[model samples]
Structure formats: C-alpha cells, structure tokens
Target chain A: MAGDGRDERAWVRGAQAGSASDLEALFRAHWARAYRAAYLVVHDAAGAEDVAQEAFLAAVRALDRFDGRRPFGPWLHRIVVNRAIDWARARALRREVLAEAAVSAVPAPDDPPDAAAPSAGILEALASLSPEHRAVIVLRYFLEHTPGEIARMLELPRGTVNSRLRRGLDALADVVEQDGEG
Target chain B: MTDLRTELEFAPLPGEIEAQQRAWRVVEAAYREREQLPRRRRSLRPVLAFAVAAAVAAAALSPPGRSVGGWIQDRVAGEPDAEPALVRLPAPGMLLVAAERGPWIIRSDGSKRYLGDYEDASFSPQGRFVVGTAGRRVTALEPDGDPRWSLARPGPVADARWAPSPGFRVAYREGDTLRVVAGDGTGDHLLARGVAPVAPAWLPREGRTVLAYARADGTVVAVDVDSGARLLRTPRARRVREVFWTHEGLVAVRTQRELRLHDRRGRLLRAPAAAVRRELVAAVPLPGAWIMYAEYDRRTNETQLVREACFGRGPCIAIGPSRFFRGAGRLRDLTLSPDRRWVVAGWPDADQLLFLRLPSVGKVVATEDVRREFDPGGSGGGAFPRLAGWCCARASG
Candidate 1:
C-alpha cells in the first residue's frame, strides 16, 4: 500500500515541516496504486485521474493537521476509493437514464480504444460487477488489505465486507469462465 | 482456474505512469499554492474559548445586539451606499430562500413564511406548491407551509425541480439515482441512476416532459421522460456543474472551465471565450436567448456578472459592459428575478445580499445583516442563506 512505514512517517514529518521534496517523494510513491484502485472502481480513465488527483489534493490540504504516527496509505486510499465509488454510482445513474438506442450505441468496456489497450479479460470481468463490489475487490486483492482492515477502511461491517467479497468473487469467477469458453 | 487475487494484483492499469505524472503536477502545484492558516497556541486557548462562547451567547440573547451592530457597522462603514435591510424586493416574485432553519418563502412585499426544516427546496411552476426535502423525505407543501404529500425513499433526496407548465412531474435525485414523481405525488419511479450531483433541468416546453442532466461520465443527455426517448447527448465535458435548456431549444452546459451551448440535436452551438482564468459559479438563461453568468477570478477575489444575448441569426453579442461585484471573499448564488428584471447575489464577507438591475447597471441594492436576517432568534453565526429561486410573478392567494 505504501513504502517503508518508517520512511513514510519521516516523509510525513518532513512534509509537515514544509519540505517539498518529502511531499514529492510521498506523492510519487503512492500515486500509482491509488490511481489504479480508483480506475478499477470507476472504470473510466479520466474519472479515475480526477478522483485520484482530488484525493491527493485533499491530502495536501489536510497535511498540516495529519498525525504522523498514522500510516498515510489507508487514509489516502479511503478517500480515493470513496470518491471512486461516488463516481461510479453517478455514472451508473446517468447510464440508467440513457434511451435504449443510446444504451446500445455506447461501446462496451471490452472494446479496445487503441492497440495498446490492457488485457480485456480481468478488467472486463470486473466491469460486470457493481462499484461496491469492485471497491471491495480492489481493496482486498490489489491493495492487499484483509477483510477486517477493508471493513474498517470502508466503514462497513465486517460481515458486510465478507459477504461482498464472497459475492464479488463468485461474479468474477463466472465472467472469467465465460470469457475462457468464448 | 485463474486465481482472482493474482489476476487483480497483476491486472494491467493502462496509463498509470502517465496519469501519475499529470496528477503530480496538479498536486504539487496545489501544495505549493495552499494558504496555511496559523494554528492557535495552546497557552491562551482557554481565554479565547471563553471569549468566543460569551460572544455567541450574547448574540443569541439579543437581536440588535453586538453581532447585528457589528454587521451594520461593517456594512455602513465599508459600503455607505448599501441598503440597510431587505425592505422590499426590487421586482415582483416570491423568493425561495434556505436558511439554517429551513426553506422560507418571501413574498414581494417582504412577507416571509418558513416552510419547515427542509435541507433544500424549490417552487412549483405556478408557485402554488413548494417541494422540499428533509433527509430522505420529499414533501410537497402548499404556499402556506402545509404538506400536501410526502414520499420517503431509502436515500437522502436532493435537487428537487418541478417541470414547467402542465407541471405534472417533479424530478429529484435520491442518493445518486434520479427519480421522477407526478406533481400530485404519485407514480414515483426511477428515471435514471448514476447522475452527476448537478440538478436535472427541465426543457421549459408545454405538452412534453423532457429533462436534461449530466451523467457521471461527463456527457450531458436530454431524454423524453414520458417516452423514454433519448433526444440528444452532447459530447463529454471535463467536469460539468450545471445544465440549462435555453429559450432557443438549446442546452447550455457549464463546466468548471467553460460554458458550452448546444442545440436540441446535440450539435455544438457556441462557447464564448472566457477572459482570465475565472471559474464559472452560476448561470441562468434570460429571455430572448440571452444568458447571464457569475464568474469568479481566484487571483483577484472578484466576481463579474456578464450578460450575453444572441440576436436573430448572427453571432451572440455581449450586451453592454460586464458588471464587477467585488468583495473580500467569493460572491456566489446568482438568482434572477421572476420578471427577468434584476439579479441577486449572496456576498458573505460583506454580510449583504446584492440586488443588481439587469440588462444594464441601473439601481443596485445591498441588504446588510443577512446572517441575522435569515437565522433570526438563533446565534447569528450561521451561514448566509442561499437565494434558491425567485418564484414566478403571480402571488398565490
């Protein structure tokens, strides 16, 4: 999730003390995974960028008040994932109102925008799941957070996190198997 | 079988590095430009706390006391020409104002009635009934503040707007999903899900129910609510804030950076070049295909209200000179009068409501002590009330 905890703490302390290099080091270390988690949930490149950027901006805004003893990844991840969920929910709402013709006209996520498109297998499977399920999976697997940790990060009950994980895994399995057969 | 964890852990996130590079620039710039507020010292905290508490208690106990006196002194000393209070509206219309207490309906003669504890509210097309939201409940209340009907959903309701004449529909957002109900509070159904927080704008047409709203993906879409037909979908804007259906059957989309106008068929019409790096705060469509917008420049801390009108066939012409409204802080919430004669803005720093005459700069009215005016009988430290809408010209009897 983040680099060495000791190093991260030192960076946080230095950044709070007005060290630009420490802040850059912190941002550079965490920006990739945060953007990845956001993109996995929102399924939009530009939106993921916006969500991740906003999260970092929020972090910068709250840097002075942040406690150095706490790890910064979970805090930043919480903001990124929540905003990604919001973005996904909003996208779903807009898609729901699309006329049948327009809905059909929109391209599927599996359709590659360019030759350098990422592997469509897992990403396409993940796209079938709702944003809530996507968020749980991203936190659990990509960020390597345990269910309890994820529950706390997401502010969801442990039981709810387990159930979401179970349901999301089942859905992903079905999509991957179907893609293999096809 | 592919391990789900392995697949997720290794799944390619295209453009990760590029996205980070771009985002870092913005984040670093913001970090460099942030204004650091001085932290209070621990030694004198108790004394400061006591003083603040006493001031708050004193303001609560007396109306024209210290807080109101400070507001008046600030206005009179700072702006000698500003009006003392909202004695009368510059134009004919009821105004929907939301304060700390709830939504209030102010008549043209400055008579106001609080409409219960709704978080946000709007007037029906005829100003006959007001639809207000409190938590998850959307209630339709008569002008007298009596509830005609209420619908409670699972999620918090917000951005409720009543469709224009033949006002049979009310569209509102309930926790990211857009739902529509009959004006009589029946046939409540989901119109769309995943809508941007921006309120859906109804095409002010008779005999048909069409609604335009921004999708989360940044596209603006207009759909026929009755037939479930997609009439138009404009190309995605980066981050859309407001959408308006203009008098010429065109849609105006306001993003953080620009204002874009599109026809009913989703063709780009015109986007006036914005001078300076000013952010668009609010905009309203005026009669005769004219538009007025409040744009704020962060560097100067000023908001300019500009009027642009499109005549016959040629290019849309900007009318007269843009009026500058300066304040110590941001001036926002530009609401036009029902008769299209005046525009009112909320200036929080000055604790005043500015009423500027339209078309050309005519008479300007600035009402002071707005926080005390809206949050009467309470601590005068509440946020300035928002000018939700200036209702239609007809007074409900």
Candidate 2:
C-alpha cells in the first residue's frame, strides 16, 4: 500500500481512460498485498492465486464506477480477504463433516488454530486459529492496519477486533519469540 | 528475534511470480473486455451512489462467519439475490432435515416444525405420517410432530421405513436384524438376520409387500415380506452401501466405488465404470427412466452430480454419464422431487442446501443459514443438518 498517492490517483484516472499501462501499474501496486493477504488467510497457494485473480477481476468490473478520489488498496483488499475467509470457512466445515462421517466426533473449533505442521511454524500456527481470527491477525500485523481501521474494514466491533487479535497472538506466542529461522 | 510481522513478510510464498503473471493476464483481459462495453447512463443522485457503494462494499467485505448467504450470494453465479434464509422452497413440497439434535419438517410455505429428538426419520408413503428412530425406540408420528405410536426393540433400531400405499407394514432394523411390524405398530417380528447396516428399500409399487436389502455378506436380496418368499439374490457385491428399488421393478445396488443396476430377478444388467480417486458417494433411480448420482473426488475434494438416461427399466443404454453441478466439498443426500426435475443436495461445507435444477443447470436456487434456521437457538456451530427426505411428493399435505 506504500506508494506515491498523487501517482496512484493519476494511474486510476488514466486506467479509467483505457490506459493499459496505468491499469498494469495499478495492478502491480496492489497485487502483492492482495495475494499475500489472501495466502495468509486461506493458506493455499492455488487458492491464493484464485482469490487474487477474482478480486482483481471484480476490481476491473467496478473500475468505471470507482471514484478516483478514493484509495484503491482498501477496495481491492476488501474483496481478497473476504473471499479468502469464505474459502477457509468452507474447508473447515468440510473437514468437520469428514470427521463426523468417519469418527462421529464433534468438530473441535479452531477458535483458539493442521497435522501438516511445517518447519515454518508461523503460517501453520496461524492456520490453527479459526478463519475469523486469522483474518483479523492478517489485517492487523500482515497488512498493518490499525485496530480501528480493521474494525471498520471487517464490519466488526473494535472490542471484537481487539479480542480476536489477543486470541490470535496467544495462539502464535511460541513461534513469535523465536527467530524467523524457526 | 524478529516479530511475527517480519517472519510473515519473509515467509516463502511459493510460485509468487508465476501466480502474479497468471493473475495479471486475467485481470488485464477483464479490464479490456469491460472497456469495450457500451457505457450505461449514470444519472443517479449522490445519495443513491453512496448507497450503491455501501452495498458493494458490504457484499465484498462481509465476513462469511456472519452471513454465508451474502458470502455465496450467487456461488455458482446465476442468481442476483440469494435468500439469506429458507423463506420458501422453489417448488411446492415439504422437506425433512435431520439436524444433529432431531428431525424437522419444513412445509411448502417455508414454515418448519421440529419432529423430535430422534436420530433418523422418513415420511410415510403419502407424507401423512413420519417414522423416526432413536436408540431402541421407533416411533410413528403425525405430521405435526406428535407421536402416534412407538415400538421399542431389544437393541438400537435404525433405517425404519413404511410400506408403500395404504401403509400396511413398517420395516426397520434392530442391530443387524431386519424386523417388520404392522402399520398400527403391532405384530412385530424378525424378517431377516445378518442384514447389512444399509437402509432397506421398499418397492414403490402400490400395495406391494416386496422389499430389497443388503445382507452383511454384501449380497442384495429382494423378498416378499407377506409370503416370506425369496424372490431374487445377486452375487455378493464388494462393499455394497445402498439398494434402491424403482416402481418399474429395476433394482440398483450402489457400492463404495460403483453403481450396479440389476434386473428384478437379480440378474446383472449394467453399471457405470468406476474412475480412480472418484468415488460414487450416493445414487438414486428416478422414475421415467433416469438415474442421478453424486460422485466425490478424493484428490480434488470436488463433488459432482451426474445424470444418466436409461433406455429401459432393467439396463441403461450407454448414453454416457452427463456430469453436471460440480462444487467444493461433499454434496451428500441427493433427494429428488416428485416431478424429478429438481435434485436437492446438502452442501454442509458452506452451510448451504442447493436445489440443483434438473437436466443440468437451468438454475440452482440455494437456501442459506440452514444451521441456524434448523437448529433454532443453538450457536449455529453444531453439526450441519442433513437432508432427511423430500416429503409430500405431490404436496397433498
């Protein structure tokens, strides 16, 4: 999201005038966070690409209706993070159904966060929490949005945002203190 | 030690550049296509524009944990507005949904009433009565969720079903033994032993006392319950899961990986070939010469609904399986409507009950918030409800 705001505004104006270069620049500017934010939320490489692509497509369709005066980062990210959450929730439910059919056990909530425990424990630990918790953590730390900004972006209460952040950090506490090599 | 932010930024995101290139191509293509379209007149007031912007933002940013209907408003992308709740079914009929707590009767008008805390239930022939099983008790209940009669077996009873037309007998399984009782809940007697745990299928013919069930040894058998006559017995099928009987006298036996159609006399007719990693989860033979089945891919986690047209009652012509309606996760319990034009499948992965329009996708109407709608005051986080059966085939109720 860090870029020249004046240039971003000009790029939006040019893209609306059918300038492919401006559209490409605008895309490159937002694609990283959109893709990374989606990856952190959904935790699938192919799915992250899909979420990013769909969000970009949606942004293109809404390009004409978009007001150039407004920032594009939040608009594009709104699509990416939301679709990622939907994808994750659906996967969780399907896993629960599989567990039920095979073992007849109630689904343990990820409310507090895979057997695929990777050597890279941060993403794995992030995956341990529920999708809602993951979304807030990604928005706060990965995307660097303020608590109030995250609350508004996710349509959640500020208290709810803080609580989710607390729980999410608690889940990641072990890996947090360790160096990135862990 | 670095904090979580640095670790995340440094995380090795595989195929980042390749993904960006692929995604950019798609984005640029969409951008170009939209650029070529004719512009629409935008004469809206500022207030209307802001409202539109808010709706778009709400739709795009809304968390699925809050509202799945909005999350998947048009999941497969056809409808403009998907109902957040089951306001009404697309067609006129009753639906039976078996949640973890109990079974419920959703009427044609979208009004629902809980039947009871029974584990299993199905409507009687005409949808006037329901038979439900819980623990060792099988109770017959009126349409209003009131129990009319119950018969307790010595062990756990399951898969209880009523006889066709006039409803003279009710057949159920107690442990591994198949048992039958009169329609009035009297004259309980053992029908067979060593029965498979699969639910028995009753002959759809009016006043017919013939029933087909799988034995524990994996053979499908049809018997005349009245005279105790063994009508037909097929060679042992491998991992037979279900047996379905059509009104036209054709018996379809479904196994873990294949769907085999057999003649009324238990002769092997035909079957769809099994594909690797693609397991046939559920299949049902619809009257008027059509068989619909749901298949799941173990590798991809995609559930596909395929329809095959039959040349006759016994064996189907190899017109090939027409694959239609593929979605994420497992789409279980394919229940056909009275007209056979609609197939309802429970998509628990998304908390969605999709009514797959028949003959392939003319339209797919979905009802969301099913967990909350069916679970009443529960946290909406319990086991996703199962579609027990579609009742009142003709909506006489």
Candidate 3:
C-alpha cells in the first residue's frame, strides 16, 4: 500500500480537486499499512478498522483544506496512530472501572503464514507493553518516523519518546530471549 | 538482541485485507454522500435594501408583534426553577446518559466521562461494565470507558442488553437479526432472523438465560436461549415499542397505543378500560405487582404518570389517581431507581430532569439545564440527553 512520492502527490492533488478515482487511489495505497498500524496499537480487529476508518473520514473532511504540496502519508499516519492511541487509552480506563487487573492478551494475527513473518513470541511481547509504549515502537520501526516527529504527533516531550522507545525495546528483547530459552 | 525495528517491520496483522475492503467501502460511501458546505455570496446591496425595508415595516407592527410573541412564550414555557450547575445527583447510583456528542457516565457526585463515540449503550447487569454500539460494532467497555472486547457484525448494531448473572449472554439487534454473544465476546451466533428492531429483554432471574424479543411479524415471543425452546408467543400488537418481564410472571408489551400484559402462556391480560385511550410512553415494573407508566395526551399537550396493580390473574387495577408532572412538553424515558423508590424523566422542552419519589406525596425534584450539564463544551442547543439507566451503587474504592 506504499505510494511513491510522485504518484502520491498526484493522487492528493486530484483528490483535492474532487476526483473520486484519485481519492480511491490514495485510499488503496495507504489502507493496509494504516489498518495494520492501528491494529498493532489497539490489538482488536474491529477497533483497528474503526480507528482507520475514522482517520480516512477525517482526511476526506479536511481534503479541501489540506495543502496539496505536502506529503499525504505522514499526515494520514498521524491521524491513524493518534486515534489508535486514544482508543487504547479509553479501553484502559474502562478496564480500570471494571477492576480488571490485566489487559487481555492480543489475539492471533489474521495474516496468512509467510516465511518472513515475525515470530508469535515477539507479537505477544509487543502486546504486553502498555499502548503508549507500543505506539512509540510502532512509529519508530513500522512507520519509520523519527523520535522528534513522533513527539510532535503524539504531543509528548522528545525525551519521553526516547525513554519509551528504550524501555519498549528492552522489554521486547527480554521476552524474546525467554522464549528462546524455553 | 536483534534490532527491534527489524522485528516490528515484519509483524503481521490478521484480516488486514478484509478490514481494508470493509473500511474503504464505508469511507467511499461517506465521501460520496457528503454534502458540500455552502459558500458565502459576495454581494450584499440587495440584502441591505430588503433588511432596511423590513425593519421599517417591523417598527410599524411592533406593538401587536410583541403581544403575540409574549402570549406564545407564556404558553410554551413551564414554571421553571432556578437552574444550578449539576454538582451532585439527588440519589446514590450512577447515571448512564446519552447526549448528542456521545454517551456519558455520570457519577453520583455529578462527575462525568464521555464514553467515546457510541450511539446507544446499556449497563451490564451489576453495573460493572457498559456495552456500547456504533455502526457495525458492539463493544464491551469498562465503566471508565475502556474497551474490553468488540464484535463487528455485517450490519449496524443497536439495542444491546446484557443478561443478568450469571451474566453469560448479550442480546442485540443487527439489521433486523437478533444475535446473542457470550459475555466475554465469544460464541456469537444468530438467535433469530428478521426480528424487530426493539432491544431484547432478558428475564431478571439468577442463572436464567430466557429472553423476550419482538419479531418482524409483530408478535412478541419469549424463548429460553439455553434450551432453544419457545417459552411463550403472544398475539401481535399494532406497533410494538418494547417488551418487559414483570415481577408477577407476566410479560408487559407496550405498543404506541396501549400497554398489554400477557401471562407466561401468552394469554392477554387486559388493563382497566379507562386506561386504554391515552398513549403509553414508558412503563417500569414496580414492587409487588404494580406497574408505573407515563401516558401523554396530544390534544391537551399534557403527560401523566400513573401506577396500577396487575396480578396476572385479572385486569390491572388503578392504584391511585394519575399524577401530572406539569411541563410545556412531554416527559419521556421513564427509568426507576435501583431501589425502586425514584422515577426519573427527561423533559426536553424545559431542559430539566424531573425526579419523582414514589409511593408517597409524589414530591418532585427538578434539575434544570440538563443539556448543558451532560454536554459540557457543547452548543447547549442540541437534543436533550436521554436517560439510559440508573445503575446500582458503585463498588467501594
């Protein structure tokens, strides 16, 4: 679903001009990764779909106001990741009200099997991190956003983003090593 | 340790393609349906001319216009008390209220948390959780507004009700199909196809999974979900609004025109003939075979709250004269307190909530400016909030 710079820019221009085909092209190019990033943060298929759907809807609402010269991917990704974080935070508050001690384990991914797939152990370890920590790791590694950009997107201090990335990576490493030992 | 970035870059997400297709369809539909905002026109000379002429005419008619407007205001505005900010509730339990922004959970001390963008919501049996629905998804949320589990259906979901404990079943309507899911969000299966849009009512008994729902064919049917057997099937009403399981082993079916009670075997148990003509708004089962209901009169533009005793063997007897809560408009969404001592109604026309203490002098406590209280930071002019439920006491912190 990745779109190259020229194609992405052209689609954004056409979409802003009210061309449905170009809008669809932009959606198709960004849908999968957007949905995946949201899924990783919220860890629920339905919630991820909702978060991504809301992000695209927000984009459409703001299309006329958007600057066509700017790149579209980071803008869309920002909305997706931020909404996913909000969804996860709301779920955490609900769990506190219910007095549940532990968040539910992440469900098995729906992706078809591939040799290059990350191990289930790593995915499980990723789920064990708080949603805030998971969001930092996802932005840094999956979305390829820099720490400063993530801090801006999430409204967090740059130092806080670095600390979360460090702690999240260390936790994932510990889980993977234990899985290897067992 | 391996580079964390390498592992994350290759992480797989389940149902990625299907999710994308589903979401894109919705997004594309929304985009196609969006109406363009109207742009401002550039000229104002003709508008200024018309406004000046109208202002001259208005001055000539000012005396008569003022009199007519004042008369209309007197007719529409009820006796309004000084509205204070919602600082605390008059009772002890939490209140689930639905405003235009979303559903909100208001604590006993009048603190509130907006439970994200849900359309309809209901409290779990013990007040431990809230189940909310939006679009095609039904989510089980913690009281503070976190999601526990969510199930997405093929159609939009509505009217979700969690069964009483051992709280195993949740029944909801998804585009005319009644679906039941296990309380923990597993074992979701179709209970009835082509059912009514009304929310299913579970029998309020311990360890029982019997549910009553309206069918598209107009009949109100009760079934035992565990045994897959129909417990009772009653004759159809004109337009069934809701159905409830009464404490006296009868099912109360409310249509727009009348309230009818049926026995466990589905025999029609009639109410007093005098109570038939008025439009039944809402009803709740009271202690000791009594039913409290609100009835509206369109001609007089008045609403009355009445209590009647129905023993299931004979016609319902009027317990006393109906009490009128004087208001400029209708009072709706009658919800009884957990202790069954207070009944709350939302008066949208007056922008207040009327609390009626039952079985006594019928003392009324009216809280004003309810719309602003529930919808903080909102326009204060949207639709009034509907009282979803008055839950039991919160667990001790």
lDDT by residue (tens digit), candidate 2, A60-119: 665776889998887676667766765565455445556768853654432212222134
DockQ of each: 0.13, 0.15, 0.14
Candidate 2 docking band: incorrect
Docking category for candidate 1?
Answer: incorrect
* Residues B321-369, model 2: lDDT tens digits: 3766776667788888766677788876656787766665456776655
The C-alpha local distance difference test score for the whole of candidate 2 amounts to 0.72
Positional deviation of residue B6's Cα in model 2 after best superposition, in angstroms: 64
Point out where model 2 deviates above 4 Å. A1-182, B1-81, B312-315, B318-321
The C-alpha TM-scores of every prediction are 0.56, 0.56, 0.57
Q: Residue B371 lDDT in model 2?
A: 70
Give lDDT: candidate 3, residue A40. Answer: 77
TM-score of 3: 0.57
Task: Using DockQ, give the best candidate's number.
Answer: 2
* Candidate 1 runs further than 4 Å off: A1-182, B1-64, B67-79, B272-276, B311-315, B324-328
Q: Model 2: C-alpha RMSD to truth?
A: 16.1
Tens digit of per-residue lDDT, candidate 1, span B63-96: 2233444433333221323433354577888888
